[model samples]
Target: MKIDLSEVGRPQSPGARAVNAMTCDVEDYFQVSAFAPYIARDSWPTRECRVEANIERILALFARHDVKATFFTLGWIAERYPQVVRAIVAGGHELASHGYGHLRASDQDRAAFDQDIRSSKALLEDIGGVPVIGYRAPSFSIGRGNLWALEALREAGYRYSSSIYPVAHDHYGMPDAPRFPFYPNGPDGLLEVPITTVRMGGRNLPAGGGGYFRLLPYALSRWMLQRVNQQDGRSGLFYFHPWEIDPGQPRPEGLDAKSRFRHYVNIGRMERRLEQLARDFAWDRMDRVFLPQT
Candidate 1:
């Protein structure tokens, strides 16, 4: 999600202050299953204990800061860790879908993608005890080539999606879409809450937290959130994953040197940065913050 807290409701609301939403991308150790070729999906079930331990740390930190968040969880993880999903719900966090197995929505064709969304949503709602209204594609996988994914997301009953990143990147970013959240006309009139970025000098600055947030210094990340909300008159969506906070997660072998670096770098500082963000801003779950007027 974007983090431009200070610039939100600027010229638009004039003096209104916008609310920032915090979200977590929940996946099991094996669901990153991207490195599946190297580590095999079957082996993941055994590795989840470590993932669960890390998530507990995150939950404790959020409690300390009194931040309510949304967890877009994979159905597979929900099925495996029902207690984790229950805990998230009991803590009053919104439960949203992060697909079934962390597959890229863009990578799956229409029929498969459609099933993935339906299955994941049903699974998360059943386990988390909340009507799931939000979705975030695994790895920000929606782009021009897969614009059709929005129609499917709408058809599957999602109201808002935090999957677009309007920045140029090798894996996932839609560079020209609106920088802030807007309804991208789709079957369900999907609201695209893009990962935050600032259009500067014709280039987009990475303002959304995740790998970018951890890679950049905390001062810069926090300042960018304030700058976007204060200057742009829109709320910033800030998201990170439970795994991101776990620096000691087992590293998968066989990823290219660069892939390994991007996935694992800065895990050590992620939890601290998250705490700082919670204390600095008013963060709520997406279901609570993204309500549109009828």
Candidate 2:
């Protein structure tokens, strides 16, 4: 996504601001769906598990900044490391689902998708001791072809979602979708809070967090977020993985050039940039940022 650097000098949001959402997709690097080609799910037990240590680093960072975020956790990790899940809740962060086993909704049939959501939600709520009303599909997998996922989410008792990335991508994106939160296909009362994007040249460009944040200059990311809040009057939902903050974690072999580049290019710089992000804006949980007033 091309950012119009001209907006870098834009002013902050005017009085009465909406705090942007800060989120973490709580999955270990080995569990990344993109690496499925190189890593075997059954072998997940053999790989060195870094999610617990990485999560603690993230939790300490948030605590240092006094920021509260929503953690979209994988059911597999939560089930194996229930203490880590409990720690997230005890740290004053909202816990939500990132699906079981990181399976994409597009890759699953309706029955499988339904089972994934129900079981994941049950596990999260059971361990975290709170309702898991928010969910984000693994890798923003819900798109134009899977609007049925929205209905299923509502039926599964999910009140909101942040699963659709509005910008175009080789793997996942709904380019024509709205940049901010909206009800996809008019699914009644089911809010689909898309990842934030900036509109320019009549096309939506992804400015929200993820690999884009890692690839872009911090100044540009900051500018686009400010533009979204100050000019568009919207709350930005920024997301990243706990693995993003752990540069020293083990790197799997046999990765293609593109995969290796995308995953490892700037791993060393993420934590410091995240520290700046934590201080730059007021952050809150996803539900509080997107949910409507009574």
| RMSD vs true structure, all candidates | 4.1, 5.1
Most lDDT-accurate candidate: 2
Task: Say which candidate scores most in TM-score.
Answer: 2
In model 1, how large is the Cα lDDT of residue 115?
95
On residues 1-294, what C-alpha lDDT tens digit does candidate 1 reach at each position?
222212122233766666788888998555663465677666666664565676688788889988888988888888888889888888888889899988898779999999999999999888877899889999899888888788788888998888888898887787887776666673237777888787679988888787889898889888888887788766778888788887777776678887677778888888888888888877888867766546
Tens-digit per-residue lDDT, 109-162, candidate 2: 999999999999999999999999999999899887888888889999999988
Weakest ten-residue segment in model 2 by summed lDDT: 1-10
Clashes of each: 20, 0
Q: What is the C-alpha lDDT of each candidate?
A: 0.79, 0.87
Tell me the lDDT of model 2 at 162.
87
Q: In lDDT terms, how accurate is model 2?
A: 0.87
